[model samples]
Target: GAGVSQSPSNKVTEKGKDVELRCDPISGHTALYWYRQRLGQGLEFLIYFQGNSAPDKSGLPSDRFSAERTGESVSTLTIQRTQQEDSAVYLCASSFRGREQYFGPGTRLTVT
Candidate 1:
């Protein structure tokens, strides 16, 4: 079984640009979550998707951040008009029913 994976591992972008991060979750998992950890800060839930229901976007930082999951599988996070404050480690996790999620290596975004 393939575990969750995130691309780039690190990204450096200029402020006000747009960036896209990718995540590939394990097979058969029905729940996917996105979180952000800014340096030494704790993990902040950004969004979650379960099966076919509506995605939980309550934790998204602002209108610039958005995510989408395709049929309980792969997911992508897009940050539009990226700002300096958006620089952080974006993590992706997946599990069955949001229980015991497995994490990816994460994409470290650095805004300059």
Candidate 2:
């Protein structure tokens, strides 16, 4: 499989709207992670997935953000009631041992 891929490379939506971002990690990789990078900040961890389970989600900034994956396949991150502050580049990474990771281009979300 390719390194990593993300869909809807860019997105713009009104406040309170909802959006879903998708990520496809390399084949055979069991570790997936979601992060967010604002205009001028480093990536902030959002969620981590091992296989189909997420044991830690303490990095989630709010309850409005959620993520799920299917047995090491594709993963989706949904943002509900999107806010201007939610506008950022959503980054996805995958790894075999959960150490060295490959990253996707990221989905750019903009809320007006």
Candidate 3:
């Protein structure tokens, strides 16, 4: 069984540019989540999707951030107009209901 995965593993871009990060969740998992961790900060939820439920995007920092998941599987997070403040590790996780979430290594985004 595949665990959650994310890539570029690392990203470097200039401020105001855009970046797209991808995630692949484990099979049969009905719930997916995205989080961002700034230096020395705990993981902050960015979005969550469960089955057909409406995605919870309340944690997205701004309109520049968005994500899409297809059939509880792969998901991509796009950050438009990236800013230096957006530099952080973006992590993806998946879980079955009431189970521990499995986390991806994360995409480290650096904006300069």
Candidate 4:
């Protein structure tokens, strides 16, 4: 019934470390999406999940990035071997068919 929510609103990790980001989409929303926004840049699509089927992960930047969503609930985005270039705001959104998505506050990641 609530809007999207993301854990660890801000994170700072050293390079090469691994980090796990979490997102909880609104209840009953069938389409969930993840995006990344670098400073002064537009949002970049990272992945999409619909229902219990395979996720559309075409937007992932590299093999070190992955995500999973169980049913229409919580989802996690894991980043392995973090690099400075990976520093950005990770955003999650969800929506039903034909409706605009509701976005989470975003996790501001800073890789040192």
Candidate 5:
């Protein structure tokens, strides 16, 4: 079975800039999630999308972060005005339902 994948395994950006992190989930997966993990900390949920359902974004840190999923295929997480506080590893996960999520390699974002 194919696993979830993410692009630009590492990214370096300047403060106040923006970055787009990409994720390609396993084919046929209907649920996708975005999470952020700070240095030495636990993962923090950012958003979730299910087939044809409204996205759950209750965990998004602030207005600068957003995510989109196109029909259960590729998903992207966009962060506007990147800041030092926003620096973290952005992880993506996909699953058939809401459990047993398969995780990607994660995109490490570094803001200077």
Candidate 6:
């Protein structure tokens, strides 16, 4: 199976616009993660999904941020009423139980 893949490698949108980022994880991986990285900063964990359910979503910065994964397949991250501070690279990772994580190339989002 293929590694994780994210769509729209680059995205530029107005501050108030909404954006949807998609990620396709490797088949058979049971754990999926979403992270955000601001310019020059470390990756910030945003959410984690096991199978089709998310058990830890506390890392989501605000109500405007949300994510969901269907089983071990595709996942979507949505940002509503985007702000300048929301500009960053969104990364997705998937891992099998007790194995190392495989990260996606990431989606670079710029809010003007």
Model 6 bad stretches (over 4 Å) = none
Per-residue CA lDDT of model 2 for 1-112, tens digit only, reads 4689999899999999999999999999999999999999999999899875644788999999988898888999999999999999999999997779899999999999
Per-model TM-score versus the true fold: 0.96, 0.95, 0.96, 0.96, 0.97, 0.95
User: Per lDDT, what order, best first?
Assistant: 4, 5, 3, 1, 2, 6
Question: Considering every candidate listed, which one attains the maximal TM-score?
Answer: 5
- Candidate 3: stretches off by over 4 Å: none
The candidate 3 region of ten consecutive residues with least summed lDDT is: 93-102
Score candidate 6 by TM-score against the native: 0.95
Clashing pairs in 3: none
lDDT, residue 6, model 1: 97
Model 2 per-residue lDDT at 5: 97
RMSD of each: 0.8, 1.1, 0.9, 0.9, 0.7, 1.1
Model 5: pairs clashing at backbone N, Cα or C within 3 Å = none
Model 4 TM-score relative to the real fold: 0.96
lDDT digits (tens) for residues 21-55 of candidate 6? 99998888899889999999999999988875545
Predicted candidate 1 versus true structure: per-residue lDDT over 58-78, tens digit per residue: 999899999988897889999
* Candidate 3 lDDT, 1-112, residue by residue in tens: 6678899999999999999999998888899999999999999999999998899999999999999999878999999999998999999999997389999999999999
lDDT of 1: 0.94
- The CA lDDT of each predicted structure is 0.94, 0.92, 0.94, 0.95, 0.94, 0.92
Better structure of 2 and 6 per TM-score: 2
Position 56, candidate 6: lDDT: 86
Model 5 ranges off by over 4 Å: none
Candidate 2 pairs with clashing backbones: none
List ranges where model 2 is wrong by over 4 Å: none
Task: Rate residue 33 of model 4 by lDDT.
Answer: 97
